[model samples]
Target: MTREYKRNGNVNLFACFQPLAGWRHMELTLSRTKIDFAKQMKNLVDIYFRSADVILWIVDNLNIHNPAAMG
Candidate 1:
Protein backbone atom coordinates (compact mmCIF):
# COMPACT_ATOMS: atom_id res chain seq x y z
CA MET A 1 0.00 0.00 0.00
CA THR A 2 1.16 3.51 -0.80
CA ARG A 3 0.09 6.71 0.91
CA GLU A 4 0.65 10.23 -0.21
CA TYR A 5 -0.02 13.50 1.49
CA LYS A 6 -0.35 17.03 0.18
CA ARG A 7 0.04 20.22 2.08
CA ASN A 8 -1.60 23.54 1.44
CA GLY A 9 -0.10 26.67 2.95
CA ASN A 10 -1.89 28.86 5.41
CA VAL A 11 -2.29 32.62 5.71
CA ASN A 12 -2.23 35.28 8.39
CA LEU A 13 -4.70 38.13 8.41
CA PHE A 14 -3.43 41.49 9.52
CA ALA A 15 -6.09 44.11 9.99
CA CYS A 16 -6.65 47.65 11.21
CA PHE A 17 -9.78 49.49 12.18
CA GLN A 18 -10.68 53.13 12.69
CA PRO A 19 -13.84 53.31 14.73
CA LEU A 20 -14.27 57.05 14.28
CA ALA A 21 -14.07 56.86 10.50
CA GLY A 22 -15.65 53.44 10.26
CA TRP A 23 -12.74 52.37 8.09
CA ARG A 24 -11.00 49.04 8.11
CA HIS A 25 -8.17 47.43 6.20
CA MET A 26 -6.87 43.91 5.96
CA GLU A 27 -3.67 42.34 4.70
CA LEU A 28 -3.10 38.67 4.11
CA THR A 29 0.27 37.00 4.14
CA LEU A 30 1.60 33.49 3.96
CA SER A 31 3.55 33.86 7.19
CA ARG A 32 3.45 35.87 10.39
CA THR A 33 6.81 37.55 10.98
CA LYS A 34 8.10 40.74 12.51
CA ILE A 35 8.93 42.06 9.07
CA ASP A 36 5.35 41.49 7.99
CA PHE A 37 4.03 43.42 10.98
CA ALA A 38 6.32 46.31 10.15
CA LYS A 39 5.19 46.30 6.55
CA GLN A 40 1.55 46.36 7.66
CA MET A 41 2.19 49.37 9.85
CA LYS A 42 4.04 51.05 7.01
CA ASN A 43 1.11 50.56 4.72
CA LEU A 44 -1.32 51.90 7.28
CA VAL A 45 0.76 55.02 7.83
CA ASP A 46 2.01 55.63 4.29
CA ILE A 47 -1.00 54.66 2.22
CA TYR A 48 -4.14 54.44 4.32
CA PHE A 49 -3.81 57.17 6.90
CA ARG A 50 -1.38 59.61 5.30
CA SER A 51 -3.94 62.38 5.46
CA ALA A 52 -4.78 61.90 9.11
CA ASP A 53 -3.35 64.22 11.73
CA VAL A 54 -3.01 61.50 14.28
CA ILE A 55 -2.91 57.75 13.91
CA LEU A 56 -3.36 55.47 16.84
CA TRP A 57 -2.79 51.76 16.88
CA ILE A 58 -4.11 48.99 19.08
CA VAL A 59 -2.53 45.66 18.55
CA ASP A 60 -2.53 42.29 20.20
CA ASN A 61 0.30 41.15 22.42
CA LEU A 62 1.80 38.85 19.86
CA ASN A 63 5.56 38.53 19.73
CA ILE A 64 5.56 39.79 16.15
CA HIS A 65 3.73 42.93 17.27
CA ASN A 66 6.70 44.12 19.32
CA PRO A 67 7.65 47.77 18.84
CA ALA A 68 11.13 46.70 17.79
CA ALA A 69 9.57 45.19 14.71
CA MET A 70 8.93 48.67 13.36
CA GLY A 71 12.65 49.32 13.17
Candidate 2:
Protein backbone atom coordinates (compact mmCIF):
# COMPACT_ATOMS: atom_id res chain seq x y z
CA MET A 1 0.00 0.00 0.00
CA THR A 2 2.92 2.37 -0.58
CA ARG A 3 1.39 3.81 -3.74
CA GLU A 4 0.42 7.45 -3.29
CA TYR A 5 -2.72 8.93 -4.78
CA LYS A 6 -2.18 10.67 -8.11
CA ARG A 7 -4.41 12.94 -10.19
CA ASN A 8 -2.76 12.97 -13.58
CA GLY A 9 -4.25 12.08 -16.95
CA ASN A 10 -7.83 12.95 -16.21
CA VAL A 11 -10.42 14.46 -18.53
CA ASN A 12 -13.82 16.06 -18.11
CA LEU A 13 -16.92 14.77 -19.84
CA PHE A 14 -19.94 16.92 -20.60
CA ALA A 15 -23.15 15.32 -21.70
CA CYS A 16 -26.91 15.82 -21.96
CA PHE A 17 -29.84 13.68 -23.04
CA GLN A 18 -33.43 14.05 -24.16
CA PRO A 19 -35.40 11.01 -23.08
CA LEU A 20 -38.49 11.94 -25.02
CA ALA A 21 -36.71 11.83 -28.34
CA GLY A 22 -33.98 9.43 -27.27
CA TRP A 23 -31.39 11.94 -28.27
CA ARG A 24 -28.16 12.77 -26.53
CA HIS A 25 -24.91 14.70 -26.94
CA MET A 26 -21.55 14.51 -25.24
CA GLU A 27 -18.15 16.13 -25.38
CA LEU A 28 -14.81 15.69 -23.71
CA THR A 29 -12.21 18.24 -22.70
CA LEU A 30 -9.00 18.29 -20.77
CA SER A 31 -10.47 20.74 -18.24
CA ARG A 32 -13.76 22.33 -17.28
CA THR A 33 -12.83 25.98 -17.12
CA LYS A 34 -15.34 28.80 -17.53
CA ILE A 35 -14.40 29.43 -21.13
CA ASP A 36 -14.71 25.76 -22.01
CA PHE A 37 -18.08 25.53 -20.34
CA ALA A 38 -19.30 28.65 -22.10
CA LYS A 39 -18.26 27.26 -25.46
CA GLN A 40 -19.98 23.98 -24.74
CA MET A 41 -23.18 25.78 -23.79
CA LYS A 42 -23.08 27.92 -26.88
CA ASN A 43 -22.70 24.82 -29.01
CA LEU A 44 -25.58 23.14 -27.26
CA VAL A 45 -27.92 26.08 -27.67
CA ASP A 46 -26.86 27.65 -30.95
CA ILE A 47 -26.39 24.32 -32.71
CA TYR A 48 -27.87 21.26 -31.01
CA PHE A 49 -30.88 22.78 -29.25
CA ARG A 50 -31.65 25.42 -31.83
CA SER A 51 -35.05 23.98 -32.67
CA ALA A 52 -36.38 24.72 -29.23
CA ASP A 53 -38.05 28.06 -28.56
CA VAL A 54 -36.41 28.26 -25.15
CA ILE A 55 -33.77 26.33 -23.29
CA LEU A 56 -34.74 25.35 -19.76
CA TRP A 57 -31.33 24.42 -18.52
CA ILE A 58 -30.40 23.03 -15.14
CA VAL A 59 -27.13 22.14 -13.51
CA ASP A 60 -25.56 21.19 -10.22
CA ASN A 61 -24.49 23.85 -7.71
CA LEU A 62 -21.16 24.39 -9.37
CA ASN A 63 -19.71 27.87 -8.87
CA ILE A 64 -18.55 28.14 -12.48
CA HIS A 65 -22.02 27.40 -13.83
CA ASN A 66 -23.41 30.87 -13.39
CA PRO A 67 -24.73 33.70 -15.52
CA ALA A 68 -21.41 35.47 -15.18
CA ALA A 69 -19.69 32.53 -16.80
CA MET A 70 -21.92 32.86 -19.82
CA GLY A 71 -20.82 36.43 -20.36
Candidate 3:
Protein backbone atom coordinates (compact mmCIF):
# COMPACT_ATOMS: atom_id res chain seq x y z
CA MET A 1 0.00 0.00 0.00
CA THR A 2 0.98 3.61 -0.62
CA ARG A 3 -0.08 6.84 1.05
CA GLU A 4 0.73 10.54 1.20
CA TYR A 5 0.63 13.05 3.99
CA LYS A 6 0.88 16.79 4.33
CA ARG A 7 2.08 18.06 7.67
CA ASN A 8 3.15 21.60 8.39
CA GLY A 9 2.88 22.25 4.65
CA ASN A 10 5.38 19.54 3.82
CA VAL A 11 4.64 16.69 1.50
CA ASN A 12 5.32 13.19 2.72
CA LEU A 13 5.18 9.91 0.85
CA PHE A 14 5.05 6.43 2.26
CA ALA A 15 4.95 2.89 0.89
CA CYS A 16 4.58 -0.51 2.49
CA PHE A 17 5.08 -4.03 1.17
CA GLN A 18 4.92 -7.50 2.64
CA PRO A 19 6.11 -10.86 1.47
CA LEU A 20 3.43 -13.49 1.14
CA ALA A 21 5.50 -16.52 2.16
CA GLY A 22 7.49 -14.80 4.87
CA TRP A 23 7.07 -12.48 7.76
CA ARG A 24 9.39 -9.96 6.17
CA HIS A 25 7.86 -6.57 5.54
CA MET A 26 9.26 -3.29 4.32
CA GLU A 27 8.18 0.30 4.77
CA LEU A 28 9.53 3.61 3.46
CA THR A 29 8.66 7.22 4.06
CA LEU A 30 9.96 10.45 2.54
CA SER A 31 9.12 14.01 3.47
CA ARG A 32 9.71 17.06 1.33
CA THR A 33 8.58 20.62 1.28
CA LYS A 34 7.83 20.17 -2.42
CA ILE A 35 7.32 17.39 -4.94
CA ASP A 36 10.27 15.03 -5.09
CA PHE A 37 10.45 12.58 -7.97
CA ALA A 38 13.69 10.99 -6.82
CA LYS A 39 12.37 10.44 -3.34
CA GLN A 40 9.30 8.74 -4.75
CA MET A 41 11.39 6.32 -6.77
CA LYS A 42 13.66 5.66 -3.82
CA ASN A 43 10.66 4.81 -1.69
CA LEU A 44 9.58 2.24 -4.26
CA VAL A 45 12.98 0.61 -4.11
CA ASP A 46 13.54 0.77 -0.38
CA ILE A 47 10.01 -0.26 0.58
CA TYR A 48 8.36 -2.44 -2.06
CA PHE A 49 11.17 -3.70 -4.26
CA ARG A 50 14.08 -4.13 -1.89
CA SER A 51 14.68 -7.80 -2.48
CA ALA A 52 16.36 -8.92 -5.66
CA ASP A 53 14.64 -12.33 -5.50
CA VAL A 54 11.19 -10.77 -5.44
CA ILE A 55 9.56 -10.22 -8.80
CA LEU A 56 6.12 -8.73 -8.29
CA TRP A 57 4.18 -6.29 -6.16
CA ILE A 58 0.42 -6.11 -5.74
CA VAL A 59 0.16 -2.49 -4.66
CA ASP A 60 -0.04 0.70 -6.68
CA ASN A 61 1.67 4.11 -6.66
CA LEU A 62 -1.24 6.06 -8.07
CA ASN A 63 -1.58 8.82 -5.50
CA ILE A 64 2.08 9.77 -5.58
CA HIS A 65 1.49 12.07 -8.49
CA ASN A 66 -1.46 13.85 -7.00
CA PRO A 67 -1.31 17.00 -4.94
CA ALA A 68 -0.73 16.52 -1.23
CA ALA A 69 -4.19 17.65 -0.13
CA MET A 70 -6.53 16.45 -2.76
CA GLY A 71 -9.87 14.70 -2.57
lDDT of 3 by residue, 17-64 (tens): 455656453334445422454454455677657776654545345544
Off by over 4 Å in 3: 1-7, 21-54, 61-71
Per-residue lDDT of 8 in model 1: 82
Better of 2 and 3 by lDDT: 2
For residue 38, give model 3's deviation from the true position in Å.
5.6
Error of 1 at 13 (Å): 0.4
The whole-model lDDT of each prediction reads 0.88, 0.86, 0.49
35 Cα displacement, candidate 3 (Å): 9.3
Candidate 2 clash pair list: none
Alpha-carbon shift of residue 47 in model 3 (angstroms): 9.8
Query: Residue 45 deviation, candidate 2, in Å?
Result: 1.2
Tens digits of per-residue lDDT for model 2 on 1-71?
A: 59898887888788877778898888999997888889988998889999989877777777779999999
Off by over 4 Å in 1: 1-9
The pairs that clash in candidate 3 are none
Model 2 alpha-carbon drift over 4 Å, by segment: 1-3
